[model samples]
Target chain A: MQTELSGQLGIERAVFGFTPFPAVAAAISRAGGFGVLGAVRYTAPDDLRRDLDWLDAHTGGRPYGLDVVMPAKKVEGVSEADVEAMIPEGHRRFVRDTLAAHGVPELADGEASGWRITGWMEQVARTQLDVALDYPIRLLANALGSPPADVVARAHDRDVLVAALAGSARHARKHQEAGIDIVVAQGYEAGGHTGEIATMVLTPEIVDAVDPLPVLAAGGIGSGRQVAAALTLGAQGVWLGSLWLTTTEADLHSSALTRKLLAAGSGDTVRSRALTGKPARQLRTAWTDAWDDPAGPGTLPMPLQGLLVAEALSRIQKYEAEPLLGTPVGQIVGRMTAERGVQEVLDDLTRGFEEAVDRINRIAGRSGPS
Target chain B: MQTELSGQLGIERAVFGFTPFPAVAAAISRAGGFGVLGAVRYTAPDDLRRDLDWLDAHTGGRPYGLDVVMPAKKVEGVSEADVEAMIPEGHRRFVRDTLAAHGVPELADGEASGWRITGWMEQVARTQLDVALDYPIRLLANALGSPPADVVARAHDRDVLVAALAGSARHARKHQEAGIDIVVAQGYEAGGHTGEIATMVLTPEIVDAVDPLPVLAAGGIGSGRQVAAALTLGAQGVWLGSLWLTTTEADLHSSALTRKLLAAGSGDTVRSRALTGKPARQLRTAWTDAWDDPAGPGTLPMPLQGLLVAEALSRIQKYEAEPLLGTPVGQIVGRMTAERGVQEVLDDLTRGFEEAVDRINRIAGRSGPS
Candidate 1:
C-alpha cells in the first residue's frame, strides 16, 4: 500500500522490502519513508554495481537511495603512492604479528594478501555513487562527512537529493552550505562514528542552529517514542542503524554474538574507538578493552585504521567465534531482544508513536486554558 | 588543633561540606580536609546548635563534619496522618490551585507561612545531630533514608566519628548494620531530591555492593582526578555535594536564583523523588517548564510534590526574590565554575587525618589489600 511517505518518494512498500535485507530502506519506503543502502563495505566496483542493480530491479520502479563514506579528513589525503610508501615495514610487521598472536592465519598463497592504504579508496566510493546514479536512485548520502563537491554537483545534476551526516550543529551548517538537502544529526549514542553530544540536547540545538533546514535525528533511537521525541524536538524523521542489526533479514552472521546482544542491557555498551578510529558505540568486549588500554598505541586515523584491521576483522567473521570482532553497532543494540521481520519493527514504531502521543496528551491535559 | 570525632572517635580528615555555607566548616577544619554542617537550614530542634557550638569550640581543634539530605527514595513510611497533619490547609490549596493553573506563587502571606519546607528543613536538619561526642569532628554525614538506627547511639555512645548521607546499596548495607563509620553514595546529581542512577554507573555499583564499607562517593563527581578516578571507582575517602553553589564566603547572601552551575561535560542528570517526592537536577530554566506544568497532578509524595512549586519554595525562603531554596548537593555541582579557599579545604582533611592516624591507623588503611 502506498503511504504519505511513498507519495513523497514515489516508492511502494512491497517492492522496497525485497531489496534491502535489513529491510530498513525497504520498510521506510514501504511505510512512506525513504530507505538508503549503505555502500561502505563493498570494495569492488562490480560488487557494489551488482547490489545496486539488485535493488533497482527489486524496487519495481520505486525510488531508493545509496550511502557512501567520504570522510572530510584523512591522513592528510596522502596520494595512493605516498600512503603506500608511508606504510613502514615495522607497522606492517606489527599488524601481522598481532593477528598471528591471536591465532589468525595469513591469507592463502597467491591471493592479494595485503590491501593498500589508498587502494580503491575514493575511486571505489565514487564508482558506487556513479553506479547508483546510473539507476533510478533518488538520493545520495555520505556518512562520515560531506560528499566531495564534485559528487554533490554530479548528484544534483541528476536531480538526486544530497544528504550528509553531521555530529554537531556546526557540521550541519556546513552540510547545508554545501548544498546538501538533508542533515543527519547523529548523536553520540548512535552506532557509528558519532560526536559527544546527546540526542536529547543535540536534536533541538541542531534544529534551532540550522533553522529551516530539514534534519533527521539518528542515534540511540530504537523505539517509536524515541522517534516521537525526536520529531517533537524538531527532527523531520529518524535515521535508525542499530535497530536493523538484529533483524532476521539483516546480513548478521554471528548467532552467538547476536544472542549476547539480545540479552544485554542499555548500560552494557560503551563508546570506544577500537573499530573505526572514531568514537562509535558498540558492545563492550576484550577487543575494545585492548584498544582502550592506556599503554597501547592509540588507533590510527580513519581509512588507515579501517585498512589495518579489515583483514583481521574478515578472519574474525569467518571464524564467527569472537565476540569482539564484529562491526560497530549503537547502544540500542541492547533493545534487540529478538530477530523479527522489518515490517514488524516498523509496526512497532508506529504503535510506539501513537502511544507516546497519547501519553504526552494525558500529561498535558489541564483544568484550564493554556 | 586535633579534636576527636566522637568520644573515642579520633577525628579523621574533615570531609563533610554540605552546608548553606560550606566555607565556614571548610575553614574550621583547614589543617585536616574540611567539615560539613549537616542540613544547615532545617528549623527543627537539634539543628545548628550542637554542630555550630562544637565547630566554634573546636576551631583550633581540627577539621569536622556536616551531614544533610541526599535521600534516594522520597517518602516511604510517611503515614496519612503525617502527610495530612504536616501540610497546612493553605499550602494544600496552593498546591491544588497551582496544579489547576500550572502556576505557583512565590510566597504566601502571614497565615499561610511557616516552615514550608526549604530553608526550614535545612534549619531543622542543621540541629538534630550532636556535633560533639568526644573525638574531634572529622566528617559530617546525612542519611537519606531513615538515619542509621544507631547514628546517635553509636556515634554519641562512642564519642567521636561524625556520620553522613547515604542513598542505596541497601543504604550502605544499613550503614554497615547500624555501626556505620562512614558511608555516603548520593546519586541523584546534586540539588534537592535525586536517584536516577548516573554517577558513571553509581560509583563501582555502590563500591562492590558495600564490601568493607567505609566508602564515600557522591553523585555527579565533577573533576579530572576527582578523588581521582581511583577513589570513586573504590576508595576509603571521597564525599562532595553542592560545592559548586556560591563559594566566595562573601556572596553567601547573594540571590540563590542567580547562582548557576558551570556547563558539565556529562549531562546525564535525572530528577527522581528521592528527597522531596519529585525529581530535581541543576539545569537552567528549562527545568521549570517541565516541573511547573499545571496539567500534571502537582508532584506527589513527601517533601517532594510540595517542593515542586516555585512559590511554595519562595514562601519558605521569604526572600523578596526567589532564593533558590534547596538542600544537599552532589559532586556534579562542582561545575559551578568559581574558586575560593582551596588551601583551607584541603588542609582540614589532611591535618584531621594525621591527628586521627596518630591515635588510630593501627587498624585504618591497614585492613589488607584494597
Candidate 2:
C-alpha cells in the first residue's frame, strides 16, 4: 500500500490514524503510521497549541497531521452565541424533556457543559490553522469540506500537504480542483458526518474520478484485511477514525461511552441527524432513538443542533446515563472488542495485512512468498 | 478463489452471477462462473420449468442455481388476491396519483399490469421449488429468508446445496443453523431488499459468524478487484446481481430503464421501501421520490407496497416514462457503462482480479508471479 503520499511524508506505514487526543496521535506516529489529530474539540486555540506542543515533544520528531472542521464558504460575523441563539426553543425543550425522561440529571452550576461550536466556525478554524502551522505539521486535513483556496496555498507554501474528506467522487473532484493534496474517501458507514456512498463503492469511484491524485479509503475499515481491501480497491492507503476511539491513549473521559462502543455490533449503529445536525453514524442509544422518533421534535441543522444537544449530552455523560450514552462511531465499532494500545493495534494491522496478502495470493493461484 | 463451494459446483471461477433471465444465467455458466437465476418472477411453474429446460440445453451441462423469494414461515391459505385486498385504498390512490402526475400512461384494455403477488406467496414458491428440484439444479438459494427445514432436507437429499442471503452476522448464523450450505452476505448497497450494513463491514462479520460454511460476498461488487477484496475478507466467492442487469443477455424490455441504469453513478441510487414492502436499493426516480416525500402517504410494508405500485411501474415501463422508469439496482450501477456480453464482463472480471492480486502482492513487498 506504500504510495507517493506515504513516501512524501516519510511514514513507515500507509495507515493514517485519526484521533482527537494528542497522546494517541503521538503514539500512532511513534508506531510508524501517520497520526492526525482532529482539531474540532479544541475550541480554545491555546488548548490546540498546548496539545501540539505536547505532540512535538512526545512524537520523537515523527511526522503527524492536524484535521480541522471548516466549511468552504465562510460564515463571517457569526459568533458562537449567535448560532446558539438561532436554535429553536422547541428543539431545546425536546432535548431537556428527553433527557429528564431518561432519568439524566442536570450538571453542577458553573460547570462547563462541553457546548463549543466555535471550532466549527471558519474564523475559529483559521485561528486553529494559525496555531497548527506554527508547529511542524506535515499534513492539514479538513473534515467538513474543502478549505479555502488561500488555506491550501498557505499549507502548500509551508510544504504541508492539504487533504480533505469527501463522501462522493464528485466531491473528490471538487477537492482535486481546489488543490487538495490527498482525498479521504469517507463512506456512509463512517463516524461523524458521512455521505451516502459506502467505502467499497466510493473508493474506486473517487480513485477513478481524481486520477493522478491519491485517495485514502475511509470508513468501516478496522482490520488489516480491510486495509488490504482498500488498497486493492485502488487506494494509496487507509484513513481510519473509529478504530482509535478505543485505544488506551484515547481521552474519551467516559467509561460508559467506551463500554457501549466496545459492546456495539455493526447492526448497533444508526445514521441519525440527532448529532451536529448532520447524518452521523453512532451507536444506537436513547439519544438517537428519541430524536429519530417521528413524534419527537426533529433535530436542527449543524451548529445549531450541536449547540442544542451539547448541554444535555454533557449531563448524560456526567451521570453515566446508561441508555442515553453514546459517541460518534462507525460500523467498524463492531470489531473493536478490546481496548489496546496504539502500538498493539498497529502490530495487529500489519500482521492482518500479511495474512490478507497471503490469502489473496493463494486465491489467485500463486504461491505465497517464502 | 476455487473454494469448496465453487469446486463442488464445478465452477471455473468463484464469481456467482445472479440474474432473472435464463439466457443470462446460462451464458454465465457457459462463461465458467456460477449462474443463479432469480425465480421470483417465475410466477407460473410451467414458465420456470421451461426456462430450466432451456438452461439445461444451453449451459452445456454446466451447473446453475435458482433463487426464490419465500418467507421462512408459511402464510397458509393466503392467496395473492387476499394480500391485494389487505392493501389500503389510500396507498392505491397514492400510486395512481404519483404515476398520473408523472405523465406515465396507463396500460390499454386487456393488457397485463405485471402485478403478480403469487410469486412471493409461500404456496407459489413451493410450487416453483418443486419445478426447480425436478431439474438438474446444483444450488437452491433463498432471497427472503431461510427455506423451511424440510425444504432444505429435500434439497440435501437430492445432492443440492441450500444458500440464503443474510444482511447480518446473526442472520448468517441463523441460516447456518437452518442447514444452509452457503450464506450470501448481501449488504445495504445491494439491489432489491437489503439490510443496513455495507459490504465492507458485513462481509467479514458474516464470514466469521458462519465459519466453515462458505460465505459469498454480495452488494457493491461489480469489478474483479472487489472480487479479490471479498476473497481477502474471507468470502469464498462474490455474488453479483446488478452487474448482470446491463449484460447483453439480460431481457430488460425497456431501453429507457437500461439507459438510466447505465448512466447512473454510485450516488444515484437510493434505498427505499417504495418498490416493495421491504427496503430495496433502486435507481432514484420520480416514483421513489414521491413515496419518500414527507408530505406523501409514505410506503406501506412489503407485499402491500409491491401490490400497490406494480401497475404504476408496469405503466411507466410500458410507456418508457422517462422520469418514472427505473429498476432495482445496487451502487455498482455506476460501473455499468455499456451493454456487453456476459462473457466480456466475466473476462474483464478475471483480468481485474489478476490486476488486484498483482497490485496487492506488490504492495505487500513481494514480487509478482513470473
Q: Please name the candidate that would achieve the greatest TM-score relative to the true structure.
A: 2
For each candidate in turn, the TM-score is: 0.55, 0.98
Q: DockQ for each of the predicted structures, in order?
A: 0.02, 0.78
What lDDT score goes with residue B245 in model 1? 51
Tens digits of per-residue lDDT, candidate 2, A194-267, equal: 99998899999999899999999999899988999999998999999999999999978899889888899998
lDDT of 2 by residue, B167-276 (tens): 99999999998998999999988998899999999999998899989999999899988888888888999999999999999989899888898899988999998888
Q: Show model 1 residue runs off by greater than 4 Å.
A: A1-24, A72-81, A84-98, A110-120, A366-370, B1-370
lDDT of the candidates, in the order given: 0.54, 0.89
How many residue pairs clash in each candidate at the backbone level?
77, 2
lDDT of 1 by residue, A279-347 (tens): 777877756676677566666665556666666666665665364555566666655789887768877
